[model samples]
Target: MGSAALFFFLEPDNALLSDVNGDLVNAFTAVRDHPIAVHNRLKKLPTGSDSYYKTRAVDPDELPPLDAAARFIYLNRFCFNGLYRTNTAGKFNVPYSPSKTGRIPSREKLIEVSQKLQGKRILQADYAKILGSHVRRSDFIYLDPPYAVENRRIFKQYGPHVFGSSDMEELASCLEKIDAKEASFLLSYAYSREALDLFGGWTTHRVYAQRNIAGFVKHRRRACELLVTNIC
Candidate 1:
C-alpha cells in the first residue's frame, strides 16, 4: 500500500484503499476530510533541524487529526529518503535529513488529493483482512506489499515485522482466493528467488525501477522488479 499511487492514477469511482499503517491511513482521512485545515497547519511548521526534531519528538497521538496529519506530512518531507521507520517501541525514529527540500504540498494539491479521495473507502487494515472481507467479483485489486527479499536486510520502512517469507505464503493463499472469486489482481515485488518461486506461474513480467533505499542519490541503483498478474 505504499503511496497507493495506482489508485490515485486511475481515480476509480469506487475503490477501497488500505494499509497496515494506521498513521498513514489516518493522515489520508484527514487530508480527505479537512484539507484546508491540514494545509494551514502545514504552512506554520518551520523547516530546520531544530524544528524538525522537535516536531518529530511530539507524539502524534496527542494532536488532533488535522495536526497529526500535518506532522506526518512534515516528517515525510524532512525525514531521510522520505522513509517511515520506527523503533521497537513504535516511536518514529528516523533522523532529520537536511538534504531534503522540506517543501509541503500546496493547498491546491492537497485539495486535489482530497477530491480524489472523496467518497472512497480508506481503511487501516492488513492486506489479508482487506482481501478476505472486501474483495468481490469483478473488483480490481492492486497489491504492492513490502519487498521481502531472501537473505537480505532491506530497509525496514514499515517497522520490525515487515513482510517476510511467511507473509509471502499468505499472499499466495490470498491470490488463490481472489482467483476463486473471479477478481483480477496485480502484484509488484522485488525480483528475487523468493518472488520467482512463489509467483513465476502467474503472468509475470520483469521490470527495472530506480530504488533509493540507500537514502543517497549517489547510491541509487536500478533494481529488478516483478509484476505478477492474474489478468487475462
Candidate 2:
C-alpha cells in the first residue's frame, strides 16, 4: 500500500503488479476499473454474519467480474482484522468482525486508482518471473515479502505456506541479477539473523512498526524491522 503511494508520487510510467494469488490480482483489476460497482455491491449487502457468510460462499470465478471484485473487497473490509486467510479447502474462512462498518474506497478515489492501473501490467506470476523479465538497468524494485519469523509466522503468512527460508534464499539469488543489471532495489523484512544474512549488502537501516494486527490487545506493540537497499 505504501509502495503504491510512493510510486505514484514519483510518477513511474510503467510497472508490473505480480502476485501468486490470481484471484486477488483479478479482483483488484476489477475493482480498479469499477470501484463504484464494488461500493454499490458492498452497500447493498447488509452488515453481520448472515450476509458475510453468504457472500463468502459465492465463488469469485463463478460470479461476474465486478461482483467478484466486490466479494474480495467486502470480505477484507469486514473480516477479522482484515486478515485474508483460507481453510484446507482454500476457501476464505475469516470470521466476520463485530467492528468494521461502512463502505470501501470512495467512487472518486477508485476512479483515480483505476486511472493508475490503465497502462500498468497486472500478472499472477512468481516474483522472479516478472521481475526477471521486466526489471532492467536503473529500474527500481521494492520487495516486501512476508516475514518468516517463527512466533509471528501464523498471523503474517499471506498464504498457507507462501514464504520460508528457502523462498528467501531464492529471492536473494534474484538480487544478484538485479545487481548485475545495475538496477536500484529496496527490500523490507523483519529484524532477524536470517534477514540480515540474506540481505546484508550495500546498506541496511533499522525501523520500527507498530504491531496493530495482533489478536490480543496486550501483544500490540512496536516491533523492529529492517530496510535493505542497493544504494548508499
Candidate 3:
C-alpha cells in the first residue's frame, strides 16, 4: 500500500479524497512497460514531443461531493518513485527512469480506493483551500509536501509556487488554526529543526524513507524524515 492508500486505511471512518496536482496520480493507471507507453501514459507527453513533461491540471468542476468526515488534500501523484518537482507553469517535470521497469499501476487497489472514496471530494486547488473555511475543528488534517531542501536554490527545482518557505509559513498558520480547533493532524517534512520550530508544540518522530537518486544505476537512499503530530 502507498501513502495515499495508507491514508484511506488509517482513516477508514472518513471518506477518502485527494487533490493530485502532478502526474503522481498516474500510479492508479495500468502499468505499461513499453518505453513509448511509459513515456506517454505516465508522463502525459508524447515521445520526442516539443512539450516538456509537466503536471496536468484537474478541473475542479468534476470533483465529487465531500461527506462531513471526508479529509481533503492535493496529493502529488505516486509515480514509481516519489519525484515531486514541477515547471514554471506549475507542471510536473520529472524525467523518466532508464530502468525500463514497469510500474505497478494498481487498478484493483485504485478501484478499491474509488469504492471507499465514494462521495468524497478531491480536486486540484491552492493550498489555501486545504486550510481555509472548508477545514474546521475536529478535522483530521495531514500534509505531505515536497521535502527536498535543495528545492530552494536548484534551477531545475524552481516552479511557479509549488513549495517554499512562504508556503511553509502558511501551512504553519493553518496548523495553528487546526490546533486551536483541537483537530487531530500529522505533518511530514524533512527532519530540519526549522521545520520543527514551525509547528510549535507538535512532537516529531523519525521515519526511514527509501528515496531515489538521479543516476543511471537507479540508486536508493535511506533517509530520515520527520512526522509531527498533534493526535497523540
Candidate 4:
C-alpha cells in the first residue's frame, strides 16, 4: 500500500487496506484514531541533521502510538529520497536527505485522511492472506507489490525479507485466485521479463515513471511500468 494513492483517488465507501509493514500500519492507525495528537507531536519535531539523527536513533517502539507515528512521518519526510530502506539489523539506515524540505503533512490533511480511513479495515498482514480472506466477487483490488526484477539488484526498502522472485510467483497465484473468484483487479509492477511471464495474457499497458529511489538525481532515470488489469 505504498502511499495507498489509488485508494485515496477512488475513496470507496468500504475497503480493507493491508500492508506487510507494521510501522506503516501503526502510523495509519494512529492518524486515523488520533490525528490531532499525531499532528501535535509532529509539530514539536525540529528539522535538521542533528535533530533528524537524534530522532532516528530513538526506537519508535519505545514511544507511544502517537509519538511513534509522528517519528515515522518525520523520518519518512526527511530520509534519503524518501526511501524506507533498513539495515540487516532492521534499523532504518537511510541517510538524511538535505534536499527534502523537512515539512510534515498539515493537520487538515491528517484529519482528512483520518476521515477517509474511518470504517475501513487496516491491518499489517501478508498480501496473500488479505487477498484470500477479504476479496469477493465485484470487488476491485489494486496491487502494487515491491519491485522484484529477476537477476537484478534493486533498493531493498522493505528490510531483509523484501519481496523477491519467489514471492512474485506467490503473487501470481494470488492473482489467479482473484480471477477465479470473478473479482476485478489491477496490478502495477516494474516492466520486466519476470513480470511479463507471470502476468501474461492480461490487459497490459506500458507506462513510464520517474525513478526516485536513487540517492542522487544523476542516477535517476525513466523506468517503464506494466499496468495489468482484468476489467472489461
Candidate 5:
C-alpha cells in the first residue's frame, strides 16, 4: 500500500485504491500517511534487492490531489493475517505475524493516505453487498480473496468461522454482477483449473508473484498466479 502511494507521488495522475479485507486497516491506514521515508527505511533496514525501492518508490509532490487521489476500502472482516476465520462471538481471530524488526506502522503515511482519500468511503461489509452498491464504470476493481481450496481448511482445522465453499461461490457471483455492470475488474488467485472455472467468461493471464511468509526462506519465492479479468 505504501509502495503504491509512493509510486503515485513519483508518477502522479492515477487514482490509488486498495481493497484491504478488514483485518489490516490500521496498518494500511498507518502506511498511507507518509510511506516514503518509512518505506525507504524499511527497504534499507531489511536486507533485500535493489528492485525493492523501484517497486515502492513514488513522487512526493506529484501525488494525486488528496481530494481526488486514490481510495481505500476496509471491507469484510478486520482482524489480522487475513485469517478469514472468526471466533464464537463473530470476531476475526487471526494472530499477528511477529517480525524481528518490530511493528512498522508509519503514522504520516496513514495521514497522507487518509487525506488523499478524503471523499472516499471506507465501509465494512460483505463483498457482495459492497460491490452491489459501489461498483460503477470507469472503476478498476482488484479482488484478492483467499483461495477457495487453500482457505477451505478453516472450516474444521483452522476455526469455526470461515469463507467456506458457499462464500467462494457468493464471491464469484458478486464478481459476475460487477462484470455485468460494465465495470472493469481484476482477480488474483492460485493457478488452478477449478479456480479458473469460477470466473468462466473472464480471460486468465498467468502472472508470477513472490510469496513472503515468515520463518520461511526469507527470500520471496516465486509462485504462479492467475489474473482473471473481464477487460479484454
Candidate 6:
C-alpha cells in the first residue's frame, strides 16, 4: 500500500501493477471499475470487531466482485498496522486493533485511482511471469520482494510462502538477466551483510526510515533497509 502511493503522487504515464495477494487485485479493480457500489457497501458495514470477523469469514469468491473488493478494503483499513498476514488455513487472522478506524476509500478517491489505472494491467502473478524476456533497455523495474530478515526474532514473517536466502540468490540471478538486457532495476529488502555480499557489484545504499507500529508517534523508531539497484 505504501509503495503503491508513488504512482498516486507521481501520476506515472504507465505501469504494470501486480501482487501475489489476488484479493488486492480484486479490490483495486472494484475501486477502479465500480467505485459507487463499493463506496455505498463500505458505508453499510459495521465498524466493529464482529463486523470485521464476519467479513473475514466471507469467501472472496462467494461474494460479488464489488463486495469482495469492499471486504478487502474494509479489512485492510480496519486491521492492525494494516498487516496482511493470514493463518495456516489461509484465513485472514489479523485481530482488530483498538487503534484503527474502519475507514474505506471514498467514491471520488476511488474514481481518481481508477482513472489512473485505465491504461495499466493489474495482475495477480509471480514476478518472473510479469518480467519476461520482453523487457527493453528503456525499461525501469522497481521490485519490492519480501525483506531479507536475518534472524527469526528480528522480524515478523507473514504469508503462505517463505522467501528464504535461496530466494534472494534467485532474485539476484533474475536481476542479472534484467541487467544483461540493459533494463534498469531497483529492489528493496532487509538491510544485512549478506545482502551487501549478494549484490556487491551493484550500486547499494542503506535508507533510514521509520514506521508507526504502535499507533503513536513516540513508538516510532529508527529503521532501515537496503536499496539495491543495477541502474547506471
Task: Give the candidate number with the greatest TM-score.
Answer: 1
| RMSD of each predicted structure | 1.6, 2.4, 8.4, 1.6, 10.9, 2.6
Show the colliding residue pairs in model 1: none
Off by over 4 Å in 1: 213-219
Across residues 48-127, which tens digit of lDDT does each residue of candidate 4 receive?
A: 99999999999888988889999999999998878777788787888898575467999999999999999998999989
Ten-residue region with minimum lDDT total, candidate 5: 68-77
Q: Model 6: how far is 202 from its true place, Å?
A: 0.3
Misplaced by over 4 Å in model 5 are 1-98, 150-160, 214-220
Clashing pairs in 6: none
Error of 1 at 5 (Å): 1.1
**Model 3 accuracy (lDDT, Cα):** 0.49
Tens digits of lDDT, candidate 3, 123-161: 445655756656666787777765535443422343556
Candidate 4: regions farther than 4 A off: none
Model 3 residue runs over 4 Å out of place are 1-3, 20-84, 98-110, 148-159, 212-219
* Error at 219, model 5, angstroms: 11
Q: Quote the RMSD, in angstroms, for model 1.
A: 1.6
Question: Which stretches of model 6 miss by more than 4 angstroms?
Answer: 1-3, 152-157, 213-220
Per-residue lDDT of model 2, residues 68-129, tens digit only: 77788778778777666777567788788847433466677767778777778777788888
Report the C-alpha displacement of residue 111, candidate 6, in angstroms.
1.6
Output candidate 5 Cα RMSD: 10.9
TM-score sort, best first: 1, 4, 6, 2, 3, 5
- Number of backbone collisions per candidate, in order? 0, 0, 7, 0, 19, 0
Clashes of 4: 0
lDDT of 5 by residue, 55-171 (tens): 223322233323112111111111132223445654434333333322333546545655665444444455566688778877777666655565333233233453456676787
Please report, in order, the local distance difference test score of every candidate based on alpha carbons. 0.87, 0.74, 0.49, 0.87, 0.50, 0.74
